[model samples]
Target: MRMRASQVLALQSHFESTFTHRLKVFLAERLPEARGALAGEEGLARLEARISVARSLGFRGERDACKYVTLSFLLGEDFHEAHWAAAALVDPRHRTPTDRAEALWNAAKQRELDEFTTESVRASD
Candidate 1:
């Protein structure tokens, strides 16, 4: 489901450590109902677009995007796309150097996960 711009803004407003904790709970509450509605590439694309919009609207931090991407991936969305999106959002040009480094680290880890998932999928096929 495409989240409204206003809803995204609301999320950004609460992008703090406390809010992050709360958001996790919020997602946990809604995940079961929403997970089945989003599947495959379409779901991945929507999530990427949502993060893009959040950034464009001045959400200038990696944590929230990272959390969202992590949650989405855990919920069976495309981890590869989510990983890249999170990486790009925290890129040095877009965020602090420390954040960039962290994002790069996360990107590397996600890449590893992606490779594993790809290999596993191929094996299954």
Candidate 2:
């Protein structure tokens, strides 16, 4: 089912807020040497690249933003690869934030998901 416009905004807002908090904490916990990387010229270039790739994904939620930045900053992956992996985690329909959420929601509602989840519930008994 297609989500309402308001629902998309609400979900994206939650995603953005959560990402901001987690990104702050993640940055804080890193060592001085690591933090310094983000402060320098090379780090700035890398961060900008990540942001660009994230924009291409067309999902403005926190996860997409964080995934791009996190992979580049922490894992040291290149922009294209990190974005591709992150894109796979979300939806590939590159247009609006609502489209991404609706694609994910529809995927979650699939028969395979229902069957897979039911097995976990049965195992708990």
Candidate 3:
């Protein structure tokens, strides 16, 4: 039997809600600092907004989307517009959202490595 448009939309909404909740719980479990940072309605709304932004940026895969949100939480939600990694993410040569996401991830990883190396050097001084 064919489903009505309303039914299809309802089903899609339910799926999205479920996925969002699952993502939130997964992030909370993996990032303990988020336990207090992301509590109740306001936090949920903020997370949902960040996920929406991630999807718009072409992070359709669950893992990539999660990474986007994680970075947003770490760097601030507006990081896309201002962060150094934003250069990699918006580079025209990337040619695809997945490519942009990968570039962003690499930039973030490199930044982490650079910070660690700097801290190590400082410690040894």
TM for every model, in the order presented, reads 0.29, 0.38, 0.78
Q: Which ten residues in a row have the lowest lDDT in candidate 1?
A: 16-25
Whole-model lDDT values for every prediction: 0.55, 0.56, 0.83
Alpha-carbon runs more than 4 Å astray in model 1: 1-30, 66-125
Candidate 2, 1-125: lDDT as tens digits: 99999999998788654554455456547634457665656755655566666667564665656545554564454533444344544544545665554443344345346778999999999
Q: CA shift at 64, candidate 2, in angstroms?
A: 2.4
lDDT of 3 at 8: 100
In model 3, the runs with Cα more than 4 Å from the true position are 1-13
Worst 10 residues of 2 by lDDT: 103-112
TM-score of 1: 0.29
Ranking by lDDT: 3, 2, 1
Task: Provide the lDDT at 89 for model 3.
Answer: 83
| Cα error of candidate 3 at position 59, Å | 2.9
Clashes of each: 0, 0, 0
lDDT, residue 120, candidate 3: 100
Residue 101 deviation, candidate 3, in Å? 1.7
